[model samples]
Target: HREAHAMQKDWMRQSGIEEEEKAPSIDNFEKIAAERVHLGLLVNELVLSRELKLDDEKVKTKLAEVTNAYPNGDEIRKMYEQNSELMDQLKSTVMEDQVVEWLTERSSFNEKEIEFKELINNNQ
Candidate 1:
């Protein structure tokens, strides 16, 4: 366990990810783990979409829907419309979501349920 902790620290250093001054709670780590899993799924979906030659218009439509769902959605949409960088980021995120939807329609997964505690411990 000590070696693993050291390796994690080393990896953070190598990746230029700074360690927090205070250790994160288990819940915080769990949240991080969940986000990593989400990102991994999106990456897998993006690869699948590329292989299938999928159109990205669905993503754009979804992004518009999402923006409209927000409170002050018009202002939000205007902000994105005015800011190229934010617009690009929004587009990328929407594209990833679209890919995930397409992949879900075509792929099957084997599933097993595990306790959240077990999931967190196993990740550690």
Candidate 2:
């Protein structure tokens, strides 16, 4: 990866691409932070409005769905079961997905195709 990265950098230099490609400005950082906070607030509001609750069954199901994707599914499941922090994180993730699913079901979206780099580097 190191050699590939160096080659990529050389190609970028030769192509006259600026070195600040990955360097985001302060405004971008602020915008990203603000968007995160806004999303958090929206999720919280949705949870409270709908009285959504995360039950143990839901967490277990989500954990199973995730661990089953790995080769050592039982090992990963055991680790998540034993670790309170990991379980909590998983619970949060489950709740986030629940919120997103609710919004997606209730909302309309306009789909368009674009380059992957444009989507990821949009904030910059």
For each candidate, give its TM-score against the true structure.
0.43, 0.55
lDDT of each residue in 31-122, candidate 2, tens digit only: 55566668868888999999988777888899999899999999999999999988887998889988888888999979999899998899
Scanning candidate 2 in windows of ten residues, the lowest lDDT window is 23-32
Question: lDDT tens digits, residues 22-124, model 1?
Answer: 4333344455566666785767666675774434676567558878899888887788779998877676666566666777999999999999999999999
Alpha-carbon local distance difference test for all models:
0.67, 0.78
Q: What TM-score would candidate 2 get against the native?
A: 0.55
